[model samples]
Target: MMNWNMTMKRNKLTVLIPPTPDNVNASEWWPVKSDVNWIETVYSDNKPAPSKLQGVDVFIGTDFTYEMAKFADKLKAILIPAAGYERIIADALPNGAVVANASHHEAPIAEWVMMVAVALDHKLLQSHKTFVTGLWDHWPGRYGPYRELFNRTFGIIGFGAIGRRVAKLAKAYDMEVIASGRSNNHSQIAQSLGVKYCWGKQGMKEVLSRSDFLLVATPLIPSTLNLIDEQALASMKKTSYLINPARGNIVNEYALYQALKEKKIAGAAIDTWYKYPTEETDQPRPSTHPFWELDNIIMTPHHSGGTDGTRNRRAQTVAENIDRLTSGQPLINVIDF
Candidate 1:
């Protein structure tokens, strides 16, 4: 292990940033005047050569495969510019190294959640498509009426950062918010936000059955993987809509496709998916299922939290952690496990 006293005296830390969408504008947001030596590099096939990691004091990228960890002899910290750190291989990290992640995505993701909720309830996409084709069937006078978010129940599967933000936003529209988490510990926070909180299987069922609009905001983990299955989907109201901006696999892909296809529920707005492009030029489909053919669903390329504000805030956090490391200070947002 490097001596903190000696490292602080030297006051020169090396930060390696790989070419990632999260780090594309890193230079613009990084501390312009600092002792830190920022080394910008590229990787092929998403794997940097082991030599590139040598002498790197900090790594500011998402993916830390076993291959990269084998050579991160000098790495003191792995700072994930984004909130999700599943790509990081914790078992392979060098001993004494700390892992941390930044999160400024709640605001933007909440905005997207509400936007799509309103769109789904009001059938905005359907109306727009019809009107552009010179069809008046969707006209208020002819199509009867559209739904509003007011007084409707908004259900949340996870009561974390994103869930709390969404609950606050949902209140703005005069919606009743109810949430279920892994435990009852978040009940106090939920109460402060004027949200009804529950936990366990019974709690989840209540949220699912009563919700007019459901939002999935949980992290993907062993317990949460495929948390929403066919049986869970069947519990929802027939008129309810589902919105997911978190990890994709949290909700079973096949079950979601089947529900939408059979009109089991009203509709869905999915921002995350099962498959993604492996290369820059690749245009692989987001899922094995034909979600594009479904008109009731709104599909996005997992960009709900990719706003400029999110990027800048995350970059600032990374820069702060690097500064903390060089100064022998404790890092922020450090993951315990």
Candidate 2:
């Protein structure tokens, strides 16, 4: 049996400690109903989020752990805007507090993969760059040395929310989609999404070897860190391309750069990077990134899921969770320990 308390006062808005992404903010959170109270970033000034948790029953924001650890006594529910709660210190959360995650938050991100895949397949960026560089009149190498999505073997790694979405979209492009995900847990889920699922280490090798385009959508876990490296890339067909809209560290950056430089695989489009924007967000990626020097690699500013509609989705989730907060219904996306 569970004992619940409702003594803490309720608020209408999601509190953002370190405001969410613009794609998320503009797309939804900030534009929510006028009655909500959203506390914009909590860490820009070297402070933690706990400074403001007193008497607030609901926390609709990101990275609430440091704040939770410092101010656990007053919290009722914590609903984060991001799908992944890795930024929060989960183990340290107070025993009485409840949590809700945003699983569908990956929609924008997974959709970004589809866009990048199209760009790579059509060689859009490459052709446009060449045209702008004074080669506008004539194009070379078989109309961009392009490839089509039809009949291509598209392999999706980590058939969780994002990977499964990517696979479904790939099918619309006429791609033969096969997915490898966490062992035993998501096989039925993958099949329901129209993907052929393979599990564990062997599954990864099989998918890597056969895929014409490989998409890395796995999270950054100990077992998944550097999951794609020399041996894995070596197993891939030299004509295949890799797309990572997921975490950066999942694929070893140096190994990938070497694979591209050596032409081990066709090319890659990388959205996530080893280094992120510091306090400042205007600067371009660092020179240390190997993808910057290689035309074969397409490196975006970690903007894969940064379309303008993301914020709306976030706020809606927050709102619905707030509604459910009092209803005592099971949360839609709670991350279990």
Candidate 3:
């Protein structure tokens, strides 16, 4: 078992769970309540009152705004139920508080990535749309031959947990997997997975130019923002398809739109977006550009990894961490700013 210096003297820990869409019906999956030592409090709104947050030992939510932090006087840990911590204002967190995130989303997200890759390569959505409209242009004899994933080069940017999972799945399809990251730290692991890995600008160029299907799986950080700009997009093969299950800004929004409009690349599958619905506007456009006008793109509302399995596993992880906090054990997946 892991160990930590900090331990709660209280018999029970108050865990405040907000009513975010991701946290819907969380009581069904959270296992800690049965333990009797953990108290689970479900807030009615995404933004809870200061009174709701006071004395809370744990806050189980994704968005940790400054306002939430201002009232979190007794918070021990802010356990995000998901991997992405970009929404969290780490600077706003109170002293002695630790932030942690969970990652059971790799499998589901990899599945979505591969699914969309095959769909894009096969032109499945386009074909379906045309065929359903009584058009026979997509007929095997009428249309040009479709591409198969077999023996194709699958390039991945940011070879982290999700990228590793994607590489395994792509390899299962007999794809030639090649990946690049910020450093050579995961080089050996990539090699063991039969992936050709490299780093630096030259490595990125090699992956971009050679891939039949390229995947963006890196996190959104300062140096990584707009990593795939107009110049980077121009480096890709015109027939290659881009798959981004990562953040939207990682690929320039306007640049991506322009590329698709000009057929700079064959197509793209984008899950994350530049714009999202806020409290005032529940249905704002996902981007400043009209990507929906393009036929060679596949878009989803950032839910590729929001699977039931991910929810259950994350809930278990949060429960385990809370249990560890009460038991004076070191937590897993702790994030340091």
> Of the candidates shown, which would achieve the greatest TM-score relative to the real structure?
1
**What is the C-alpha lDDT profile of model 2 across 262-333, one tens digit per residue?**
899988998888875445445656336557778787888777776556656765776676666545556677
Q: For residue 216, what is the lDDT in candidate 1? A: 96
Model 2 alpha-carbon drift over 4 Å, by segment: 1-49, 64-68, 105-107, 136-145, 280-288
**Model 2 scores what on Cα lDDT?**
0.73
Global lDDT of each candidate: 0.88, 0.73, 0.86
What's each prediction's TM-score? 0.93, 0.81, 0.90
* Model 3 residue-pair collision total: 1
Worst 10-residue stretch by lDDT in candidate 1?
A: 25-34
Worst 10 residues of 2 by lDDT: 1-10
* Prediction 1 TM-score vs. true: 0.93
lDDT of 1 by residue, 1-337 (tens): 4686566558888888775456455456664334677777886545566678989988877778788877898999988888877778779899999999999999999999999999998889999999999999888999989889999999999999999999999999999999998799999989999999999989999999999999999987778889999999999999999999999999999999999999999999999999987666989999999999998999999999999899889888888888788767899999876
Error of 2 at 171 (Å): 1.8
Please tell me which predicted candidate would have the highest lDDT against the true structure. 1
* Clash pairs, model 3 backbone: 3-330
| Model 3 TM-score on a 0 to 1 scale | 0.90
